[model samples]
Target: MRELAKVQGCLDRARGGLGAVLVVSGEAGIGKSRLLREAARHASDSGFAVHVGAAEQMTQTRPFGPWLDALEITPSSRDEDLRSVAVLLRAAILASAGELGSATHVVIEDLVDLVERLAAEVPRMIVIEDLQWADDATVLTARAVARSAAHLRVLLVVSHRTGGLPAIGRRLRRELLDLDVATDLPLAELDHAAAQGLAEELAGDAMWPAVHPQVEAARGNPLLIELLVAAGGRSGEGDLRCALREHVRDRTWALGDDGIRTLQYAALLGQRFSPDLLAEVLGRPPVEVASALQRAIEQQLLISSGHDLAFRHDLIRDTLGEELPQAVRASMHATIGRTLARTGARSPEIARHAALGAPRGDREALELLRRAAVEYRRLAPAVTVDLLTRAESLADERLPDQVELELLWALAATGRTGSCIERAERRLQDQPQPATAAAVHACLGLIRQRTNDLDGARTEFDTAVALAAEAGQIPAAYLADAAST
Candidate 1:
């Protein structure tokens, strides 16, 4: 394929006695693993020694897991050199003698030496998949190999997701970027023509106008496209969601209850979440939350970005969210809202959780929505209208008249004058307190002005002013300022 050409170039460079490194990066199911396989085939055909190792998302706790896989060294291996290196590497990782730091150095040096030996015998190509889930020691060893490969007939191909790389992965990527011997090959989605070709190949003569929509929906993701074609282009929302869930099941199912719960909370928090906020929502200790996050990072399910962690793909988060029962999701949202409230979070953030989490007629949610509306009134009138509208829907007859006034004002501010007039007329029928009555009249006056009814607007404004003057000083001043406009 076109993508294989670039990888084949790296293999060619290695064969020419020039060491090369190719880092293939893409989102999930974007063919990174497949590309590595293609590179391996090309290398093997060119009489190069090919070693492939894949990092396991669930088994990252095993140090040097991918390296061991690549070396294929057992305690009873027939190859003496391989056995010797594996033994040393195991000791280095385990630090059985309690000399961890020095052992790690030995491990890196031995790995570099092993690569040089392999390259000296024959051009060697090593492919490490899912480096994003590699442990710290494994990452360091790979980095060491990459640096030493510059002068040897070695080609190193490392693949990882583009997002959600842990700190070690990020540092390794940055170092590779700075190295002259390395090439960064970021795979983009296929173009319309290429995607259509893939669809046709998968579906054969049955492919038609229906395949066009599937390709469009697949958004150039090869795996998604393949799935769509396999499903006969009947990939509905539920089907797509189910597909995504299964795609990441291996990474998630291995997690403990705490880890699963951590993921659930993180999904509820949004695409990116802080450990502190997550801990607060779960009512767990920060240390406990951190451990779960570490596991997620190791599994490649979450990428640590500074102080926060994000799902490797938005689809992963969406899939998890869709699987959550409505009651549990709403309860979690309410818990998150309460936690955020304690942190003095902004109104919109707090209101979002509160509105979703709180059931119908929940006073706390209604209050939070009103507060959010007030915060958004000037900054974002549309948001203000939305929050107030939700609050209006949730408010009971015993709800304060101020909420209705705020809703009316927010609706009018958004130029939704018709709705504002209707709400104001309903509020007036309830005979609200004088101060709230004045606010409603002022809101109606604004709506009348927007409708080009100058006389009606003037009359409403006059009535508002009269009611405000009788109510109190604050009401009179507020209405007076409103009437002048």
Candidate 2:
């Protein structure tokens, strides 16, 4: 509101013929574009003329692109005489966009001259957005108009991300900061209280407490907060992934394959990572990893904090991870697991990578999975179940094995008796060897006993002992023991 009020004051002064420029700067998703809309609305309500324009990455080659867009300037006839062209600012820009695309000093003066005339007739506010993508001429025109603000009755508002700025664009930002008439508005990320207010506003009173937990996860960025809320359910997750993938891809288009691979590896490590660790994971020299990280920083995809690097937003990390192919993702995680284990990372972290990276039916992987389940079973039963389920899938051809038994026990402990019962029944129906069938029957009998169905429990227990005895070479005694009270 204070920034909006400052804009309100700028409009008031412009109406009184002492115009000023308002320069808004922030990181992407920090609400630069939204603030510009609020200021435009405020200007419109006060009876000031409002014109809005945007600079786009695709249109950077067109000099004065923002100005031409602001005025909707286009020549109706290319054959118009010099007399007609000189009298019309629209013709001047159309011509400048054609041959003088670099936008010389003469072109800058013409825009100042035109803005002065427009504001003289009616107090006008022109808003230019995405100034980081603006051509050199656009930056020059802003500086020139700001310099002539004492005479013109127009408030020029320009907004851009503070990072990834080209050299010429930096000049305009610096000069505006020095100018007395230019008000610098730098938007920082919202504090916790402010973020909660915004979240409550989005979710309403009913969801205030519900959204509290995710506010910190949003990292004080507004767009991420909204996305985190929108992405709550199973189906919304797919939609959110698609939306974020496209948005992040647009921002990361300039990044090379090495930079993208670095980001993916970084995502595997978590949001913030040590370069040396990342280097070990990638199997690259430390200097090569550093160069890739530096490129990511320059593109504003990552921010460097001392020796470690972090994604500028978690959404970037998520989208990049989502884009990796399943095979590729698993291979990378496999490498990550080995690397983390070599570096003496925690058992849980390595276990997670091992579970994610393991190939099918590998006994070593089964051992790792078993160890991980043991470590997590008492601490996090759900995590134990998920880890065992992954191991079970990998060992599909070797059903009724130790991993499957551990998964069944884990499920039963978590009160998923029905799921475990159903799984055992499906395995029995597959008609495996007699010993395997006995194991399945033993599992079912245990579930029946737990559920207090004594008659049903005996029926399953009798079948298990019979199946084990039918195999002849296997002992019925162990199966009987498994089915005992």
Candidate 3:
């Protein structure tokens, strides 16, 4: 709101003689678009004409897609008069000036060059959204235009997510500093009253009954608020899944079977995946995968992060995951695991999926799970717990009891020390097997050591070492360390 006031001040100054540039940024789903829409509405009421355009996430490589969105021009027209259209837009701005309805106000949601060019032509307010996702070319063009034509009577506003900004955005910030027309907008979180008001906007008088939990779940993502409210009280988890699937299907239906296959391959890898990995797993060329990903991005179902791609929503991932038969999902998981392993990825996430989804209880699956458990112990404790829990649930009697003990040991190795120790002690009490009891005591001893209870640690270590000795196995070094301490 402060930035808007400053921009409006610039616009007001432009009526006499001045220019402005506003740089606003926040995290993804942080209401950049919603806020821009509201600002555009205000501009319109204040007598400025508004035109909005957005850049597609998947087509950063494609030039002028965002410009075309704002202009609503077809491919045929774009080819015929690209520069001529710019001149025409310039003429429109000049002709639109002076009269109350004469000046044009434009919001180019994701492109900066398109607005920068138009700003050079006339006195107008121009807004650009999501400059972070912009291609290098767009960034370069916008910077050049902004630098060369700062004297123009225009107010330029641009917004983006603060994290994951490409290098171009950082450079632009430094460049804009030289212009002395920059205004940074920092967003504040919605307070309780404001959050309730937003919910009421979506659900009417009884909004809280439907919107409170989603508001909590969304944690202030405005786009998520829309999806959650539309999904209706969150009971439509399945419906939301189907809706996302249909959204993707409708957008990609025009592409032939190859495109559909590419999407299915990506879906099998799950959400937030690398396009390069998906290409490898599917045995398709990278170019082919890139093309399919581009098309999906144009349709807005897939969002891009450099070389990686992901479904725009968790619902989309769930939808695609559920569509495949159990056998197919298992097969794909196995294939992905093997491909990742061969490429030296060392990704525990892939291994966990393979262990849980692969139908064949091959030894590879077990090794993958064990390795995943070890890696997750350091990088992600909850994931380590999940991997071990899955492996234990699926392991057959053919598995050695020691393997089960190892899984339990991993679980206790990476978690809230108190919780894991309590669970381990309870489980050991039931089984009372020497290997399991020793593993449980070893874990408890480690937890006690971490908490600085040397006396308790020594007692648990003594019990573990005695049990291990009775079972004809050496106690682990960690237990020995606790004992010495």
lDDT of each: 0.79, 0.76, 0.63
Candidate 2 structure, TM-score to reference: 0.66
Model 3 ranges with Cα > 4 A deviation: 1-3, 47-54, 57-122, 132-141, 148-150, 161-170, 186-197, 204-207, 233-235, 242-355, 360-485
TM-score of each: 0.66, 0.66, 0.50
Q: Write the per-residue lDDT of candidate 3 for residues 139-217, one digit (tens) a residue.
A: 6545654564456666566676664346777788668756876666756556666665676688666545765665665
Question: Which candidate number maximizes lDDT?
Answer: 1
Error of 1 at 139 (Å): 9.9
Backbone atom clashes (below 3 Å) for every candidate: 1, 0, 3
In candidate 1, stretches whose alpha carbon ends up further than 4 angstroms from where it belongs are: 1-28, 40-221, 224-232, 253-256, 272-312, 396-399, 431-442, 445-475
Model 1 residue 453 CA deviation in Å:
4.4
lDDT of 1: 0.79
Candidate 1: deviation at residue 251, Å?
Answer: 3.3
